[model samples]
Target: MTDAQDLDIPTEPLPASVLTGFLGSGKTTLLRHLLSHPEMDETAVVINEFGEIGLDHHLVAEATEDMVLMNAGCLCCTIRGDLVETLRSLYRRRITREIPPFRRLVIETTGLADPAPILQTLMSDPLLVERFRLDGVITTVDAANGEVTLDAQIESVKQAAMADRLLLTKCDLVDQDRIDALTQRLAQLNPAAPILQVENGKTEPSSLFGCGLYDPASKSLDVQRWLKAEAYEHDEGHGHEHHHDVNRHDERVRSFCVTYDVPLDWDRLNAWVDMLITLYGQQILRIKGILCIAGEEKPLVIHAVQHVFHPPVELPSWPDDDHRSRIVFIVRDLPESLFQETIRSFNEE
Candidate 1:
């Protein structure tokens, strides 16, 4: 048996993305389209089978015993072990040349799976962290039934709230009015994530990936695109007048941005974030900000999903002339006043 200390781990970290959506939201369809692209040649896809009869495997072409190699050179496999084991096994196979080497991984979660657990695994597991990086989350929203699903299903709401890119699938089937309404609702739920339309699971690969602080292709941090604070700022100015009813399914979900004119105290800001996440991590779906810390010349980028946060990264310089700090929050059942009061207290001290 190979010794534990001798295990071969790849040095270069690969980007891994999570694809999630409600049932009948065209997640598998989207995956099929993505696998057909030439750019996806080196991607390893892991799909979760919810029930005994997993139809997604069959729907995807080029089936073997456990894995499928597409014509475009992508490797697709159903989840054999738990996610961690599955990932580790893939790494071993790559090391041994048992399978085609993959540069990236795409995980397709089951319809009802809460992405938080998977994210926690990716962030907290030391081995996985060293081998793979979280690129971002892409959530497919069914334009036809999305509004009703969001109305009745909390899972759907959480999926949308935590997504980095909101893909509205089946848009061709819906009328303009329905599309407009759903778009508005999704924006209300997550103002920071850009909404993209996908008809029959067709979308450019570039649009879905590269959402993290580090760009996979460029090997540099794209702080401006990663923060996207301007989206939330625009929403804050133009969209706040419309009030959602308490009876609405996503009434508790809120998206807003907070800006500070003066450079913030790093210790105070860190303490506030720690306390907030400690108390309300579950309710906080996502947080991203560009902060002008008092002592730092370059701005600091803060990112968090639920309770887990990536290490804060400092940019080389501010992206624009705006030197103010802007933080975007996508949270549930939390009032803006709570964050405002906390920041105010920190600034006062």
Candidate 2:
């Protein structure tokens, strides 16, 4: 067995994204559309099948062999070992010129898979983390059955909660009223993610990728767009209050922002965050924040998916005149009052 710490970390990490959703949520359909796009020319794909007999590979239109180069120039492959092994193999092949040069990678998870574990694998595995960077998460929502699925399945709710982009599929089959209601429900669960209607799984590739703090095109930190604090503010100002429903599947999941006007003490804030994640990591689905520290010259960017946290990066300057520290939390079964109180206690000390 290979020891995790013994593996070498790559200097230049490849950007990779996860495509996940519930069963029959149109993940494969959307993937087929993406694979056909010219923009996905230098991309590699990995599909994970759940049962003994794997059939997801056949569902992809142009996928034929273990590694198939589609007409549009993208490469498609199934998961060989696990997610980590597959990523390592891809990196090794790219290094040795065994495969075509690929710029990005996309992994499709089984409908029943919890996105958090895959995300954790991406961030936690030392070898994988060094070679592959988590670009973002794209979740496909079945508009026709989204509402019912969300109400009946907890896994479906989790997929939406952890998504960076929520793509609504099968819009043509559903009425506008149903779509609107489902949209509202999704917003309550994950206010920061932009929901786009994907017709027949066709969507602009630009919209799905580049969702992380580091912009692949500009090679710079696009903190404002990535944080999306303005969206949270707008939702709050417009009285888009999130109501907790007793009967809904995501009744326990909530999205809210906690703001601190005073500049935070770096050491104190770090300690608080460490403790928070240690205690309630499972409940804290996602965390993104911009902080103005008392002694720091630039704003600090923090991102966490469940218990795993990316190393904090400091931007050259603040995005705007607003210097207040804003931390947005998307949590499940974690009360806003508890979060507020914990922060308040930290600030007081």
- Candidate 1 residue spans exceeding 4 A from truth: 1-11, 63-81, 219-226, 234-241
Q: 95-123, model 1: which lDDT tens digit per residue?
A: 66667778888888888777777777777
TM-score of 1: 0.87
Q: What would the TM-score be for candidate 2 when compared with the true structure?
A: 0.87
Q: Per-residue alpha-carbon lDDT of model 2 for 152-197, expressed as tens digits?
A: 8888999998888999999999899999999998987888888999
For candidate 2, the clash count comes to: 0
What is the RMSD of candidate 1?
A: 4.7
Query: Where does the lowest 10-residue lDDT sum fall in candidate 2?
Result: 68-77
Off by over 4 Å in 2: 1-11, 64-81, 230-244
List the candidates' TM-scores in order.
0.87, 0.87
